[model samples]
Target: MSPPPAVWVSGLRKAYASHLALAGVDLAIPEGEFFGLLGPNGAGKSTLINILAGMVHRSSGRAEIFGFDVERDFRRSRQMLGVVPQELAYDPFFTVREFLRLQSGYFGLRHNDDWIDELMAELDLADKADANLRSLSGGMKRRVLIAQALVHRPPVVVLDEPTAGVDVELRQGLWRFMRRYNQEGHTVILTTHYLEEAEELCSRIGILQRGRLIALDAKDHLLARFTWRVLTVTFDKDPGPLPETLAGFLSGAGENTLVLRLDQSRHSLGAVLTALQDLPAQILDLHVQEPDLEDAFTDILGNMGLEQP
Candidate 1:
């Protein structure tokens, strides 16, 4: 028999008084897949994640982790799932090692020092192993939270805004670790405002809007749907006026530079070059950028008449 999905949600809904946080979301993430759950603020990404983690009760529908119902088999489901929340919650008095060990114990894992040590080394927390949580820097503390989530070696991991306040170097490191973990046959679900990161790491993406999933597909497919290209041209001299044909395509302009948007099916690179050649200015540099995840995301939301967050 095939293995159960890493995460499964059917008609999931959550209501807070008059507000409905989730309006019947249905999703399934297979084992070993790196999935991205994206949305603007108040789109219900966190609410769904909380329900899967058993931290919040769902108002309706069902959620499961590895086929174990989140509510009916809470303990078993929780044991197979690891979550890194957006907030930093920790016992300041506990040392890094102590905190991780305590988290392992909570999952009924005894003598899990081997995995704890491995996690510390992998996350670059070896030096801070004995330091009190209160003494660690914010970046170090974040690493500790990641390690704490994995203390029990859960097969499914969920990270919500893990790199929000982290520096570029730390963000790169976190992705490296996550990529390696996912490659080893573990499932990873990520939610972030960083479209570039999601574009690079996630195999599939689900975008939510106003408590409903508006888009879900492979990263490449989503990007391909835009069918647009960005052309950035730097001129050697100030071009006084753009030809009417070229001017209509201009998206932005700066000092001796022009940015144009091209619809792939309607416009060709050769045509753009010919238009530029007709101008009185010499082209210093030109860059043609393919449509990316951010562009697709913006276009999708715009078409739906929703404001991006």
Candidate 2:
């Protein structure tokens, strides 16, 4: 028989007194897939992840990891999953190596030093191996958190805002590590505020809005839903005011630059170009940018009469 889905949830809901953090979310992630969970703050992304990690009890519904029910088969399910939490929780007294060893021991991995060393080297934490946890910089600490989560080499990994507050270098390093593991048949799931990161890393994305799953689909499909291409033009002279015919498409106006959104279905690029040529301002340069994940995400939320948080 085929192995069970890496993660599966049905009607998952989590409520806290006055707030319903999750509202009946149903999702299934197959093995070897890189999934992105996206949402604005207070949109229930973290709550959903907490429920799946068994750190918070759900108000209703079922969740499973590799066919093991998260609640009923806690040990097996937990063993199959690793989570790099949003918080930086660690003991101050222990050295980096000591802390990692303790984490491995927690997972019944007393002889996991080889893998621990590999994690440190890959994450650029090898040189700080003997430093006290409290002495490490924020970026170094984040790396340790990532290494801590992976000490057991779980089949499924969930990185909750893994790159938050980190430098570009650390962010890229983390992405490479996750990408390599995902290619090796590990399921990688992450919740991030960076739309560009999600666009580049995730194959599938699920967007949450105010405790509800508003959108879920392949990244490319979501991007395709955005019917407009961005048109940016730099003019040799400032255009005081655009003509009535072109004003509707003008999304942004600068001293000598105009940025417009041209809908392929309703407005053609060539037509827009022709209209620009007729403008009072002389165009010096122009660029047509294809729709991206951020555009699609904004459009989706806009159609729902909601603002991006």
**Candidate of highest lDDT:** 1
**Candidate 1 on 116-172: residue-level lDDT in tens?**
999999999998999999998889988998998899989999999999999999999
Quick one: RMSD of model 1? 1.5
Model 1 earns a TM-score of 0.95
Runs in model 2 deviating more than 4 A are 238-248, 278-281
Q: For model 2, give the 10-residue run with minimal summed lDDT.
A: 238-247
Candidate 2 displacement at residue 239 in angstroms: 6.0
RMSD from true fold, candidate 2: 1.9
Which lDDT values do the candidates have, in the order given? 0.93, 0.91
| Model 2 lDDT tens row, 1-309 | 887899999999988999889999999999999999998899999988888788999899999999998888989999999999999887999999999999999899889899999999999999999999999999999999999889999999999999999999889989999999999989999899999999999999999998899999999899888778879999999867777888999899777999998889898788778878988878899889998888888888889998885
Q: Cα lDDT for residue 25, model 1?
A: 93
TM-scores, all candidates, are 0.95, 0.93
